[model samples]
Target: MGVFRIGFFNIFIYLCCAFLYSVPNVCGHNNMCFDCIDLEGCKAPKHFLKYMSAVDRDKVVLRLPTDKPDPMMDRCLNTGYTIKATLNGTVCSGSSDGLCHAIGEATTNFTITYSHCGDCYIACDCYSQENGNARKEGPIILTMCLAAFYTLIQ
Candidate 1:
């Protein structure tokens, strides 16, 4: 009985550790990439393009606006840019805006892609090539660990 109890407690402790480590990633907010209006040569509010990750860049295409007869549209959206990865602190490329590029890969974590733009500020969408698997996996793993611990304790 004592051995069983110790084993159960040990399992519980291990599960607790797992849960603690994963909770932050699970509950953490998603990343985002935002494209703001141009802020150059205009007195209008400073609206700038913001790209959070590579996945988001793939979703949207950067094009000069032709819908309206506004000449400023082309200037605002057509700012040739490059993406830099914040993870490894490296510059990926000088490609057009909204292009995604793989920066680095990790064994336990997902591959990170960064848009040409640097750290984004203001409104933007999150980018993930793998359909947010990394964001979802953390919670699932924690839940499984907790369930196994509970079964052992009971």
Candidate 2:
């Protein structure tokens, strides 16, 4: 029994270490928006407005239309960008709440309705905090814990 207890404790410690190691890769940098640039230089003049939102692991890229003349191109040319995440129809910002972790860490369902650089706003789709590995990790961790527990008990 004592040996089993020690084994369980070791497993618990290992799991905790694993979770900590994986967390940084999952959370990533949030609430940062920036202009598009290539190795040669700025890509703003390519007709498509490339805006990337730094939220999760996968970068969310927005491509604006080039037809019919767009004022957004001029606004986003050489300026910084700001992103706002919305939760439950309420605007999330530095005042309301930080753009990425607006409501809270658990707040998943939200839309990045406002992504602006200079005077231009980039339209985006609904975003979820769960889109990151955090969501998938939960179930995986639970399963691992359960399996370990069952093995120890048996």
Give the candidate number with the greatest TM-score.
1
> Against the true structure, what is every candidate's RMSD?
27.6, 26.8
- Reference-based TM-score, model 1: 0.26
Task: Identify the leading candidate in terms of lDDT.
Answer: 1
> lDDT tens digits, residues 72-121, model 1?
22232334332221223221221233432222211233222222232321
lDDT of each: 0.36, 0.33
- CA shift of 97, model 1, Å: 23
Task: List TM-score per model, in order.
Answer: 0.26, 0.26
- Output the lDDT of residue 149, model 2: 100
